[model samples]
Target: MDGTPAAEIVSEVAPRAGETIVTHQRVTGFHASSLDVLLRGAGIDTVIIAGVATNLSVEGTARAASDLGYRTIVVSDGCSAGSEAAHSASLESLGLLAEIATADELLTAVHTPATV
Candidate 1:
């Protein structure tokens, strides 16, 4: 599944319009990815993570982000896992390393423009 199409983002959730999407193959998205360089170039010191495989991808990214000197937050409700139990457990474990919040809370904290 590593080099297959299934490993890529689904067409149903593809980026549209001005949305910027970065795809990474590894568990820790920072390694071997342009994410860290892009973030630094853009002066982005924080990262809000939302993705699948709560225990693996999400956790790995958050940990790597934190280690890379970035403030990382995991949107608990915005992410999904193979099982609800796994999702909840991953959130709990992630809380130790990153700030956990809902999509509503993050939206309230940072307002996005109607058109970007």
Candidate 2:
């Protein structure tokens, strides 16, 4: 599955220079992968999750990250489920464990400078 078409990252969001890419075969990136170790090494305490299968892979990874004591944030508009109902339900449930924000809100927060 490594070199398969489905596994390829689209050009629109391809990794840029100086970006670290971690590949995981498990449902959650943190499982059976160096993602957790890499994050810890980088001293990153926050995680922003966004991907397909809002009720499955997305939710699973977010839950795992939260359980690992990371401040997890899922971008609502950045994920999608099989159905709108499913997506909404997953988002609601995830809200209890993680902060759910729209893509615009996330962008604003990312671009905003931190005040001392």
Candidate 3:
């Protein structure tokens, strides 16, 4: 995503079809044009986020997603942090703002819908 060239950070996770990769220009927000357009055009109602730098990118996008009225879910285990303290802090904050769940929990919830 970074114009500097797709670094190992991204190369390590090769995207499959039907997935769009948008690079963030900065840490303050989702300032990338491609990201905004793709998200909006795709009609993404919810964002199940999982990535590195838990206290940075993950947190930033999570906040932005919540503000955009998306049902955001942070996968606690799927994300990593520079430190355990930072990781825990990010999870706590996300729990206050969005639905924080484990990978297995999310998978189960997605596969099974609740009855009215």
Following a full C-alpha superposition, what root-mean-square deviation does model 2 have from the true structure?
1.2
Write candidate 3's Cα lDDT for 21-116 as tens digits.
666667524655466567778887888889878999889888888887878899999998999999999899888888999999988998998999
TM-score for each of the candidates: 0.80, 0.94, 0.82
Task: Give me the displacement of residue 112 in model 3, in angstroms.
Answer: 1.4
lDDT by residue for model 2 (24-91), tens? 88778899899999999999999999999899989999999999999999999999999999999999
By lDDT rank, best first, the candidates go 2, 1, 3
Model 3 gets an lDDT of 0.81
Over the stretch 1-116, how does candidate 1's per-residue lDDT look in tens digits? Answer: 66688776688878889876666768989879889998999999999999887888998999999899898999999898999999999999889889999999999878865555
By TM-score, who's the top model here?
A: 2
Q: How close is candidate 3 to the true structure, as a TM-score?
A: 0.82
Pairs of colliding residues, candidate 3: none
The clash numbers for all candidates, in the given order, read 0, 0, 0
